[model samples]
Target: MSKGERMKTTAREKIKQQQAAQRQREKRRRVVTYAAVGVVALAAIGGGWLYAASRSQSEEAAGGDQAPVTVQSDGSVVMARSGVEKPVLDVYEDFQCPACKQLETVSGQTFKNLAAEGKAKVVYHPISIFQREPTRGNSLRAGAAARCVADGRQWLAFHDILYKNQPSETVEGFKTNDLVTWGKEAGVTSPDFEQCVTSQKHAQAQLSYADKVIKEQKIEGTPTVKLNGVALEGNVAFTPQQLRDQVTKAAK
Candidate 1:
């Protein structure tokens, strides 16, 4: 072969080798990029799984057939005797509701007195209706923590504490730590109760129960009071004395 032809042939072979090397480098780079992305995706999924499992475990630990509070078929929490002969008062309230706070302040003691006297049975259904932006699920958190308090048999006291320390509606209140602190103040010294409150073990279940009650009862707002299956018109429709009168009448 001619020397020029030989030179051209060698140059062509060198160029082919360079192109193959470049292609291999690009392929390796793509593999590395895909591998990194896969790792990140796996990490995110694993983290989510771990979080979900932790929540599930906490819920399992907090729930049982012997729970202190009554869990209805629809998940409502009932605070009264199952077959009490006294007049029944069903109170549906949200922890984040200012109106509920007023109602509690106005008639909480009255209701407690009636219940203690066997004149009436108060069934407190802690529903969550104030779940919105900025509040960041404060109502749900409070409701769930209230369940934990109920488990500790301090529902009424903790209920009062929550309302007394209630914050404004425009911000996130009733954080987990705050709830734990309030539970302690309300005589909930059990470590299990503290764990339940802090971990929000029943948060999802509480929310589900609230949703079920809201849908079934068509509850549009908080502080809905039903006395012997009759709904009250408003907060001031019946004063504490009048409520006591009605309960006395119903018991007859």
Candidate 2:
């Protein structure tokens, strides 16, 4: 080919390379701009979610429509009698806890029997993990309702029902409505009990109790039993003999 023709072809290829480079630079700029917008959008969404979460928590803390709870003087429910001293067994439990149910059905009865016989005393320090799955009693709500029902006369029945219906954590089967029906079946006559359960107002005091128990009692797990401040670990299968033995050991 002639020199002039070859020179023209080379110049055209150089111009094509320049155009490609400009297109590449523009593409890079567009991608960077898109990424910045995405980051900004994500930050906004995160902020909104955080705000909503805080609001929900605040509502739960307020526990609308529930009456206020008065903390017991000794921080326990075990009755104290003059000159009796009532050798105390303090129990911290979660209503959803299966092991807690075991402790109740097997060992708590023995302790209650002893208390009934005036041989000892028992104090229940219920820790509310009410939101935890399998909380058959929906104890926080139920306890609050029962408090309204028995007017403080039959808290024990409320306590029993909470444990009796504890559902499995693996599945969702416990009916909050059924708990109210159960209370009525047990002879409690409060019409507003169901409302309290639905509103989750009863959980307020329970949440407060949990905070106190964790901070003061240093409780890390459910079904923790303490006799005069000494902690009990394991299921502690409740039989008259086992409870009697543990109590005897703790008393000493």
Candidate 3:
């Protein structure tokens, strides 16, 4: 090759290298700028961030105060103070649903607090809304296990444990052994409770009841919170303080 051509090739390679270096510099600058903006935004919303964190923590701290929980014949769990039932809060939820988990995290304690205070009757309808495998099975098993102990003293504790241990939708979870173990942790010492969970004794019943309620109530999704038989708006249903306010208004 000629020296002139060689020199030209060398110059082009140098230019390409310089251009690549410039691009890298620009990318680094953009990243730093974005990080700075993120810091400013976090600082601006610090209060909101703290509130969100506290709300999540509240779920971990719930279940201390609850009224007597009674399991109805149809597999629904009812929580209410004696003879204090002016307003009813029906919470329809699928154990395997992510949004249902979020709703529980936000307002589960509110349900207990309301019922304990004789403010409302909180009826928990654990249903299976998942159509696919793994999640459908998981929901059924979990719902059945919850029903197994619903009549006992540990129903509410087991209910919270199920939510805390909810698995992902794509994979199988809430295995029989885990259910039994969690039941024991929730104070279910009855041998029948373990057998009921292991054998999935209430599985078919739970499925049938879920289907019946879905059709009768025209429920389209999980985490359906109804106040006095009327569905609550998303904003009110998912917010704990808002739910309390709405229940107070209903009681009055």
**Clash number by candidate, in order:** 0, 2, 0
Candidate 1, residues 123-197, lDDT tens digits: the string is 778888865664548888888888775442566678889999988888878988999988888888667997898
- 174-193: candidate 3 lDDT, tens digit per residue: 99999999998999877688
- lDDT (10s digit) by residue, model 2, range 205-242: 66676778878988877778776677755434333455
Per-residue lDDT, model 1, residue 120, is 70
lDDT of 1 at 242: 63
Q: Candidate 3 has which clashing residue pairs, if any?
A: none
**Cα RMSD for candidates in order:** 21.5, 18.3, 11.0
Ranking by lDDT: 3, 1, 2
lDDT for model 1, on a 0 to 1 scale? 0.74
The TM-score leader among the candidates is 3
TM-score of 1: 0.66
Which runs in model 1 stand beyond 4 Å of their true positions?
1-83, 150-152, 236-238
**lDDT (C-alpha, whole model) for all candidates:** 0.74, 0.61, 0.86
Candidate 2's displacement at residue 195, Å, is: 3.0
Better of 2 and 3 by TM-score: 3
lDDT for model 2 comes to 0.61
Shift in Å, residue 188, candidate 1: 0.9
